[model samples]
Target: MTSSDPHAPHCHNVPGDKSAVQPDKKRLVSRLNRIEGQVRGIARMVDEDRYCVDILTQLGAIRAALDGVAMQLLENHANGCVAKAIGAGNGEDAIAELMDVVRKLKS
Candidate 1:
């Protein structure tokens, strides 16, 4: 799971206390559950033989919703983990990590 890119910055610093990352986990799980429901609803639509255009529209909505959730998680990571890393003198590494994710998202 580790990136081998030489230019990729790495973080070996973890929160001294695990509780610091708990909220991110909780929010991620909650968002994923909502996405799961959306997926199941789409499946039901298919079973009901919904119109192709309607199904495609719903799929687009699901994608946008998932992207919204992703943005929220990224914001949280920036404010929490990245901020902490910067405060601890690892700002370059943190920024690099964020940039890498942004690049991945773009692709």
Candidate 2:
């Protein structure tokens, strides 16, 4: 049976070409590497029984860093993938997918 949900079986619009050209691959990788290091640092802090407040602060920083990465990725999607889909007359699905991710990011 068909469902209204974009994620429903038979309604999914996964792109055939999974590898979209990423102009900022290097920058994104660099940021992710730093975030990974920060995560490891937080793990160490937890193991050392660090102050709760300090650990909380570090957690907040990591969330912000992750949000920054999300924003960059969203921008890249809008400028590259979404734009291409629009040009190809498949913008409706593209935009729906974009909005879905946007709602997720806001949460």
Candidate 3:
């Protein structure tokens, strides 16, 4: 049976090619590293009997940081991978995939 879900992953038989972000990859990695540290800090706070409000604030910051990362990734994917695929005459597939991603993001 075939699934109608557009967000479903499937094997496309295409060779995996590396796509790079327009911005510095090191900077992105650094941001992610900092987020990871924040997570660890939150864990330590929990263990150390920190206040609930402070923990909640840190969690909110983590969520915002994660959202920022997601936006950066989406922008990079659009400009690099989708654009390249469209330029190669596979825009329909790329657009469909992008739509699926957008739908999932909305959900």
Candidate 4:
């Protein structure tokens, strides 16, 4: 699941370590950059005492955008990391870990 692509999302279970490299990292990072900007804008709106409804609307958009990113990463994890785990006969643990995260995301 680990990729040599420098821009990829490398995630690792090791303490203080990064692991698997998810594809399309540049796009993912771009999306996250936009989300960060939106957050900043929302903060500015709050400072300016903008209307509650307008702020709430932006907040909703932010939530949706974050959800999109989460789903993308989730899919990549399944297709890459989980798939690898399954091939290695460690699918049970991988699947359990996946479901745990899925449950957390639902909440």
**lDDT, model 3, position 14:** 49
How far residue 91's Cα lies from its native spot in candidate 1, in Å, is 0.9
Cα misplacement distance, residue 37 of candidate 3 (Å): 0.2
Question: Model 4: per-residue lDDT, tens digit, 8-50?
Answer: 3444444366387667887889999999999999999999999
Model 3, position 35: C-alpha lDDT score: 100
Q: Which structure is stronger by lDDT: 2 or 4?
A: 4
* lDDT, residue 11, model 4: 47
TM-score of each: 0.72, 0.84, 0.77, 0.85
Candidates' RMSD to native: 8.8, 9.2, 9.2, 3.7
lDDT of 4 at 85: 69
Enumerate residue pairs that collide in model 1: none
Best by TM-score: 4
Worst 10 residues of 4 by lDDT: 1-10
Following a full C-alpha superposition, what root-mean-square deviation does model 4 have from the true structure?
3.7
Pairwise lDDT winner, candidates 1 and 2: 2
> What lDDT score is found at residue 43 in candidate 1?
99
Candidate 4 residue pairs in backbone clash = 10-19, 11-19, 11-20, 12-18, 12-19
Question: How do the residues 27-84 of candidate 3 rate in per-residue lDDT, one tens digit apiece?
Answer: 6789999999999999999999999999999999999998897777776666656666
**Which candidate leads in lDDT?**
4
Q: Give model 4's TM-score versus the native structure.
A: 0.85
